[model samples]
Target: MELLQLQYFQVVARLEHMTEAARSLHVTQSSLSKTIQRLEEDLGVPLFDRRGRSLRLNTFGRTFLMRVNKALFELEQGRQEICDLSSPDRGSVELAVNTAGTLPAILKKFRGTQPFVHFHVQMLKVEEMHALLERGEVDFCLSSPPIRGDEIECQVMLLDSILVAVPITHPLCDKRSTTIAELKDETFVGLKRGYPTRDITDRICKSEGFVPKHVYEGDEPARLRALVEAEIGIAFVLESSTWGFREGKMKCIQIEQHDFVREIGLSWHKSRYLSKAAMAFRQIATDYFNS
Candidate 1:
């Protein structure tokens, strides 16, 4: 099959609607349908199942989509390498970060050191960052501990300890330090289920033999702090993340008992070759964190 056919199939598989896919590809619906039909006929397998106006990829299509996506990404990377070779100093780096705390220090240092290099940092979920890395949409990512998966290469950038954030007016505000057990009955604000910090929060609470009485679920640290400042609930966050807080509204107490330390790091696909610009930024990141 032609590369165009694979591109069309990939888009259709992603959108799951021939009409929408056609619109996105700037082609007529009939033409897109015929192209896919020809592709399926040539392969002797149905790629998609039509259900009313919607479409879904069949088992074969799912596998085919993965391969096609990888091929497209590699092709794009090859083109980028050529472009980067021609203008290494002017090339851009796309970096994704899941948390704001670890970003500021690195970004500050990067800006001071590599003022000529362009950076695009997308604040994504940890899982979303991993997906973008796999798709070759981003060159690298910064995320928390327990960096699983065989395809990714991770390096620790910094060590952070968990802290408890409470409204200044709250009773717990008087405490210099606290245990997870002390906060068991307190109304808690937490990151949403899949966040790296949420996993740590859950593990600490579970170890203490109590579940958090969660009142709010915020995915961003800033938003979680807002909820905590409103006296809605107490939140557990990395100590570095408390930099933006004002002393009047919130107080951050160290969680001495939980051993809730996390290592923030940079990750990229091990199989992918780093672009010159990405390599420069990675080195800059390494030095920035180490310093």
Candidate 2:
């Protein structure tokens, strides 16, 4: 019934020579014999037909052997799968983030070094990221306006500047830079309220004396970027996220205010065990930003 008992039974059953099985198992013959004896007693049946120096499987032992072999094989497969999960070179990471800005670069860097590692990445609101991390649904979380709690551990991974992004043909694109006060009347595209970027933008705008007039709001930055691209509205975007702005149709301008910045951090539930992949990702993120 015990796994050890089943393993001993398997080795003994296969060799059909108790002495050889004991040596292969690195155990004394006497100890091996007692273990087999106990297993047979537990099953209430004899497992071997004994000969002087050799043991042969009896009819009942043969039938039981088939099922035992299958069970042992499956258990071994499970162990191998767990080992792969724990391995740094071959594993999967589950991550949630509030901003997608610096993430792709860090991920690209991680993939260059650990190409076999697979990823499950999500761009989520600040509240959603905290909830998922608390529930242990994700292994790591990258968030702006970083989350904290009794059950969570967090590290501020990066400090990113928020920039004003406008369509190439827009009037503000001609300016070297602009203040929140000067741009307050312009229509804006942004993430919805609960997102850290949205919250920060709102606070910064109010500190400059006006709530931004929203022309559109969404959860995804790409959508906001598209709206910016179409000249529908300018957007407050992370500097790292302005990747496509210059190459195609948008222009980016740095805002002078100190509040136009966000703290990006990595977080996880303190109670949840980190897989090697998640740990590697955490280190990679720290290195990427800290540099």
Candidate 3:
């Protein structure tokens, strides 16, 4: 029933190991166990199925945990609201990003207007970003192929075309555009699976009846060109990425056969409280991308 008891239970439910949970909470194992026991007694039902030192949430615990998470999130929001009210000019904007291509420009523009407002940016997989959005953990998410749900509000900022990048010496460099089918036999340097560009390009290749044979698989978009330039392999890159490689060592060809444009969007959970600082970032990011 106590706030302390609920907090302890949340940690235990997540870790599922009493000793590990207690260590994380900086409390003794016996004390943490006693707290959970008291909470279960108060509710008149066992929350977790226990075996030795391991714990697993039963049906009742799973249902209660959802409510507990919401309660704690609201309490944390209340605290942030109070702080935001006191200093409207200074606060932090927490953001989860799916693609980092446009971040430099967006953050540079945002900081120009609200220099005092700090940013906490995390580059996450699409699923991880969705999880954070549902939990009200992030102020906003910059995503590709836009996150869609009844509880979320999303606005497309840009329609970025995906292009094929090749070294100047490559045979395909003579053409201004190429089809996905044409690239089937060519070795590619690609972003890892979780990346939006990688996912989109994979589907494009799948639709064309063959997987892209990757000479190298990496997480960094910046290295895609370098890999291609060294004849490691050609790559699928965003149109915006072409700007950095304009010296002529690499050529970015259009995908003429498929309209391979990815929609970049700004998304936020509708139920979460939007602080003034976070709102400012949203407006600035929207304007920057639109312009």
Best by lDDT: 3
Q: On a 0 to 1 TM-score scale, where does candidate 2 land against the true structure?
A: 0.59
TM-score of each: 0.80, 0.59, 0.91
Which pairs clash inside model 3?
A: none
lDDT of 2 by residue, 42-85 (tens): 99999999978779999989998878876775575455458666
Q: Report the CA-based lDDT of candidate 2 relative to the real structure.
A: 0.82
Runs off by more than 4 Å, candidate 2: 1-92, 108-119, 135-137, 167-174, 223-226, 243-250
Clashing pairs in 2: none
Q: lDDT by residue for model 1 over 1-291, one digit each (tens)?
A: 888999899889989998899999999999999999999998999998888988989999998888998899889888778878887776778888866665677777777766777889897877778777776677788877625467888888888788888899988889999887788799988888877778888887887888888978865667887788888988888876765556879899988655788778888877666777788778887886787
* Ten-residue region with minimum lDDT total, candidate 3: 240-249
Q: TM-score for model 1?
A: 0.80
For residues 159-223, write the lDDT of model 3, one tens digit per residue: 99999988999999999899887888999999888778888989888988999998789888888
Clashing pairs in 1: none
